[model samples]
Target: MEVAIDNSEFSYLPAQAEALGVPLPPVERLTLPLADGRTLSALRFGSEAPRVTLLHGAGLNAHTWDTTALALQQPLLAIDLAGHGDSSWRDDVDYTPRTLARDVAAAVEAWTTQPQLMVGQSLGGLTGAALAASRPDLVSEVIVIDITPGIDVTAGPAALREFYAGPTDFASRDELVDKAISLGFGGTRPETERGVFLNTRMRADGRVEWKHHFAHLAAQALAAHDPGSATAPSVLHETGWDDLAAVTAPITLVRAARGFVSEADAADFQRRVPTARLVVLDATHNVQETAPVALAGLIESATPARRI
Candidate 1:
């Protein structure tokens, strides 16, 4: 089947940069072959060796960090975690942070020349912690946005779960945009449209479907069983805390005021890593999307001089 996938993923960079009042830099998509014949994909934001490496949350692609990358204006790589974006889905569906960290480590080694300031959100945050623990040489500093090992599984917005529980394929991209807007997801109509365009593809069957594997898997699960009984794959596990504890890099925990991490969770994080810095932002769970400039500022401050 001939599926028509939009290859011009970077076409919207100019507008994104313009909106942020930043100069658009050279952006390119890079793919690396994994050991199992699967591939990892990422967006290289500048021509220089990347100083930072970003990982997006569950159900999001690398482009989710586009605005944040623009605002930062530094050499960076935004990776498409396995089973999301252009990265190959795993046959085993083992998306635990420890498992995902292995692939992220591979991308970092291939795409970056030196240790990078690792920034990750939600699921990506956990993965970053795991990577820092397992491969300290690749991550010099780590920033975890709006997530911790203690996050409540049921704390996520119900609307988000409902959105994924809907049909996997839609009649048009606009339909998905409309659905997201109604569910109180994306920021604005134009922003939602752009996000939809980047995150979905046209199937050979003439329908539009999400590029991430989790959404499709959730929809399939819901179709086979009662909606109340079926849910998305769990990203949380007990070992996440051990990974956080084992990290050797400098740690900064950014908690979204209105997001999932609670005061208790933040307290627990501080207790676990007494030397870690913590900051709270007034935004939702998806801080990269909701608070890109502010998030970028944090990344900028923490970023050190580029290493040769």
Candidate 2:
């Protein structure tokens, strides 16, 4: 489903001051076939140009990077990670970075001939690291936002956990919007409301449910008898740091001041990935949503004049 941007009520901007005279880039919802037969859905900005690829954090879709994409004003493709957004859910429940990276690598290989600048947030960040490590040819530069393998994986955003642990289907859209606002999903009511609208779909059963599959998979994992079962892959597997270290391209780590990655963790990350440059922002976990302008500037600076 497309986002409603023409309406005044839905026109709440995150970094409006920075995007003041910039023309709104054209956005198109696209789906690409993967080698495994499942499809990867994405929001493509502009057309026929070297692009920047964006991967949103778990429980989020391509729309999460909408403001940042707009601020950048460059060709971009923001994809919905497998088991999240409009992408097909994996029955095997293998949401590991390697598994998700394969899908993204396929999409990248199919979409852009030149290596693209990759920016990923949280779970997406780990996936980006994995992709760069495994297929360095497809990515020119890597920017991981607010995620490090060193951070305690067992801990997650409390409000986000509570929000996801709640009911799946809502009777009314406003009810879901209210729940999102109460859970502190977005700062303003309009922004929160728009986020709910972008991430939900009306089922044939006449109920509104989240478009992403993370919550459902989380519930399934929680209910599973065996933690090591194929249905619930270990979320804290020790491969991310290795992947981060393997990347030879230019790397930038964007950390949120009030988010998960601590100062010590950042230092450890730099120690592990010697080529990584760290930039801390005064935001929360979702830096793309909270600080689009600054994040965009960092991205633009990290992106080279031409991809090799």
Candidate 3:
């Protein structure tokens, strides 16, 4: 599928330049066509060639990287993977990493023919691994944020599963924001509120619902599959290891000291992929939210110099 850069729905506004004391560059909303006839939406932070591309975790969107992007203040593109943000939802409920990687690879190819640094968090990390392995021509480096192929997937994602398993619609936006804060989705009150606002939209029915399709799609897939069956993301873990092994690019695994990726997992990753570099910080799973400046520094270090 080809990517078409459109400016109809969103445009770069100078007022959005400063965030969290970081001077953000201009941003533009863009869209690309997916192979399955769905559209992938994204935000471009600079007009310069997209030196870096960011993919958020499951259920989140491009806005999740707002603070990190602002801190980076470099030419980067943040994508709303399929079934998230303003992107088109899939009728088949195929949110597997391989499927998502094809869409991302297409967008990268459209954005630039040269190899660019790729960053992903959780689900996005799995997708980035798949892309780096499959389309080495498009990705020069891979940064997996607080997630790895050998992550403890059994009980670690309980919070995420519980959050998405609940009702999708909210009586009011404030209600949703309150719920996110209570769930510890963000570090501070204002951050939680902004996260809720970014992830939701007003429906024609005058009700507020999450813009991401993970909850609804997961429900559908769960109902159709047998009880005790692995969810769609099981393939992510199954194939992610292989993807990491196949990647030719220099890889960096940013592990949160207090997060799901354990020291044992990090050791195993190093053993499996010798080129992988591990960096640990004192934080939780959502390191981008709690440690944007540090995360930005990691990204800058992994990124290659800009092409003239």
Candidate 4:
């Protein structure tokens, strides 16, 4: 289903998005074939437009961009990071930033020959950084939203329980939507956009289950599972410090003003990545959903160094 961007209420997209020709509600849906034979769901818009890849966090699929992706004139590619949304769920894979980054790299390769603009949220942001650090050749510019390399040591799985555990069996979509509002975007979402997560799944069997594996994704996010044995993955760890320094790609970080990735981590990240600039948006950990406008502007700012 394509997003209806021409509507008055939906025209509030970033100035840069006009160049990309992003549409409202967008032609968004799944787009990936995993090596394990599972096709990951990717929300795509503007195949002919300048390429922009947006990666969402754990527990969230691409639906977070109901408002943001519409603004990009470039091809907007929002992938369900492995095991989230409609992506294949592997019980044994480690599901670390390294592996998820690899998944994103492969998907990005299929969509554009030119270096693509990569924007990531939460796990997506951290994974995007690792991807740019791991494969600078493919990513033109990088936008890390609400996350930094150092990470918030104190923020743990307990903080995510409310979001990960919601009712899957409801007779009415309104009930589910209400639950999503109360849990995820509550105070952050505008009344018109309060139940935006409804876009995450396809209706089937008179019920709406999330397009993701609740347990496996939870374990993956909390680092309790390692299905793929991904050697040593990077989270906000010290060893990956070199990776941040090694990436020569122009990187812009848009962090949630209040959330997991703390002020110190942001400072440490800026200090580490030579070509990195940081922008703290007034939002939560899920900045993409809560502050899509600010996030969109930051993404525009993260254009490849040549454009800059």
Q: Where is model 1 more than 4 Å wrong at Cα?
A: 1-5, 153-155, 226-231, 305-308
Predictions in order: lDDT: 0.86, 0.78, 0.76, 0.61
Q: Between the candidate structures 3 and 4, which one is better when assessed by lDDT?
A: 3
C-alpha RMSD for every candidate: 2.1, 4.2, 4.1, 6.6
Worst 10 residues of 3 by lDDT: 1-10
> Mind giving the per-residue lDDT tens digits that candidate 4 earns over 1-308?
22222123223344325545643334545467767776666767654544678887755676577566654344577787876666776556455677778888888777667777878776777677788888888888778777665663223344245444434444654665566576554553444243334333435555544555544344444455443311112343443566556667887777677867778777877777756787878987877766776676666655542220
In candidate 3, which residue pairs clash?
A: none
Instruction: Please tell me which predicted candidate would have the highest lDDT against the true structure.
Output: 1
Q: For model 2, how does the per-residue alpha-carbon lDDT over 1-308 read when each residue is reduced to its tens digit?
A: 33222223225443452455566655677788776778888878776564699998877888888787777877889999987777888878788888899999988887777898989998889999899999999999999998898764433556655666546778978997887788766768866778887788777777888777766655555555323221223456389988988899889998899888999989988888887899999988889988888998888887655321
Question: TM-score-based ranking, best first?
Answer: 1, 2, 3, 4
Candidate 4 clash figure, as a count = 23
TM-score between candidate 1 and the true structure: 0.94
lDDT of 1 by residue, 25-101 (tens): 88888889999999888889888999899999888899989889899989999999998888888888888899999
lDDT of 3 by residue, 139-193 (tens): 9999998887776342334455545554678889788667666766665776566
In angstroms, the error of model 3 at 25 is 1.0
RMSD of 1: 2.1
- Residue 182's lDDT within candidate 2 is 83
Best by TM-score: 1
Summed backbone clashes in each candidate are: 0, 0, 0, 23
